[model samples]
Target: MSTESIRPLIGISCGDLNGIGLELIIKTVSNNKLLELCTPIIFASNKAINFYRKSIPDSNFNFQQIKDFTRINPKQVNVFNCWEEEVAITPGQLTPEGGKYAILSLTAAVEALKAGQIQGLVTAPIHKKNTQGDSFPFTGHTPYLKEAFAAKEVVMMMVASNMRVALLTEHVPVQEIGPHITKAAIVSKLKLIEASLKQDFGIDRPKIAVLGLNPHAGDEGLIGAEEENIIKPAIKEYKQQNNAIVQGPFSADAFFARGYHERFDAVLAMYHDQGLIPFKSLSHGEGVNFTAGLSAIRTSPDHGTAFDIAGKNKGDESSFISAIFTCIDIIRQRTAYRENRANPMKKLTNRLLANAVDEKIEE
Candidate 1:
């Protein structure tokens, strides 16, 4: 079959309407080439999309609107209208309407994903403070998805062409970070990162580097005891249990400064800024935030709502575009991993079968 016929249907949730989510989505999907890779189903109303489209100068972006999946057009951009009523969209301003619609779009797309209507999801950025209410009380997409899908745990992984970084604790306060960094949490994140690398990234064997919670990696116990008491013990246990090539508790400053991160397939950071600071600096605004360990695939741009430049049309869509492709790539990698594991001899059998057919033709 042609690639387009077999392309995965990717669902996109319109983040906070007041932010640059819609603008980025319009710019990313404007490239018709993306349609060939995967059919995109954006969960938002036509009115919201049109409002952003008009802001872009000399733009001709277009999309088909559908209230249900029955009329989905695989060859065209599909807008799955979550709401029909007109809502105020004040770009660069935080409002309750924006949060309500953002959640509406998210819940609609998520339900479609759960029902197998979409193979993967690419979420736009949402304002955490405004998006939180009695209906949704999660910190971010990772935690919300974790609860929605009933995933026991999920690692918020940052992906770029250069490197992959996963966080042990995301969106946690700096003061409260210490209590969350424990032996159990470290090992759990390591396990999730390894599995995600192998299955999601198609790595046969992944080498993971762990960053320390304290400065100078506890200075070999002078700075803090997390490295010796908590971090190192967790690494040792994980290595022994899996026979995996996992090492670290490296000083965060030195690790990135000296380019030690290049030596491993992935890096595990103890907290949010510990991993993201170096990652964002190095990614050059082309990073994707991926939630690993979930049954369904979900990815988003590494950056958040750029409220400052929301209505100015100054938001960059590169990261958002990367998120879309990353979601698609992970879906393909998972498929390949499962198929290969299911029938390890499938490739060899195909080659032998081809040779036998050749012999018959020669006869």
Candidate 2:
């Protein structure tokens, strides 16, 4: 390997052993064509990966286990066995074994990414309920990755091909969205979205379309003040700080209409349902969930562990492929940003750092 040409070591975290994580892992790693792009390492138990292959019966993947991340070669499916659970790993069974194994695999993946052993991360879905049974504080994959990296700031961005969408507030109820929708939150999310585009998506100038909280942009505060009071103010502040093409508090319905997608880079949704409903409707089973504002790159399938269909061989791998592709895109941009002298974050902002600290202290 040449020092000048650094190949990205991609680490994949196997989620629920009972779910499609294993299936997708088999399909993706075996596809001879894709494996040649970079080195692929699975932070999972070899036994579990082999057990799940019976469902796909004729799968052509070779699950080769490796001891260290650095020792991985570009031509093989290098796996790091982190699963210490002794319980028998079975197909379509939600055992404590599955829960324990998922946690182990995830921890190994996080360490690899933090240590820079891998340039990108692609995590499969893990059953939150199954994990919690083993005393794990698992809400879902996005939040887990957010806390794993422990970034002072973060937002969940969903991507499907050319369409990109981000939620300002995720995993919160509709009623709670009113109180949590603060000026700083909106401003922070917009800044992160813009920076992610320029840093991870390789956009010199990103055009962001902000979605309104209320119908028809609150009818000018007649129905709701969140749009006029919160959304507009946040957008204006973001524009003052960033030179990117940041515009709109577009109504939810209108944003997806009128072919505005061709003009914008991404959409900053006001809340979980408002943003995800449209995104999932069109891109579900095919989208990738990327957690931004972390020190390292993080991405996963936009769906969760379909427990009912575990090991059924009916699980779609489109979203998982999206995750792999998203990581590739992010790594490419990061690599280019590092090699090229023209980078936006050449200097650090102590004031912003202090503000982030103060915000944490205040919270």
Per-candidate RMSD, Å: 5.6, 8.2
Query: Residue 95 deviation, candidate 2, in Å?
Result: 4.1
Give the clashing residue pairs of candidate 1, or none: none
What would the per-residue lDDT of candidate 1 be over residues 1-363, giving only the tens digit for each residue?
345544789999999999999999999888887887888999999999999998997555889999889999998999998888899999999998988899999999999999999999999988888888788998889999999899998999999989999999999999999999899999999999999999898788999999998999999999889999999999999999999999888999999999988889999999899899999999999999999999999999998888899978888899998899889888877876776789886646434533443343234
* TM-score for candidate 2: 0.87
lDDT of 2 by residue, 1-363 (tens): 231143467889998877678788777777665564556789987777777777787678886788776577777788888854554756677777777778878888999898888888898878766786445675776666677787778878988866889998887878888888788998888888888887777677889999888889898889899888888888888888775577878878977776576578899888888878788877746888898888788788887777777777877777876687678667766656655546546424322432333343233
Model 2 residue 47 CA deviation in Å: 0.9
Best by TM-score: 1
lDDT score for residue 177 of model 1:
91
Instruction: Show model 2 residue runs off by greater than 4 Å.
Output: 1-6, 90-95, 132-135, 342-363
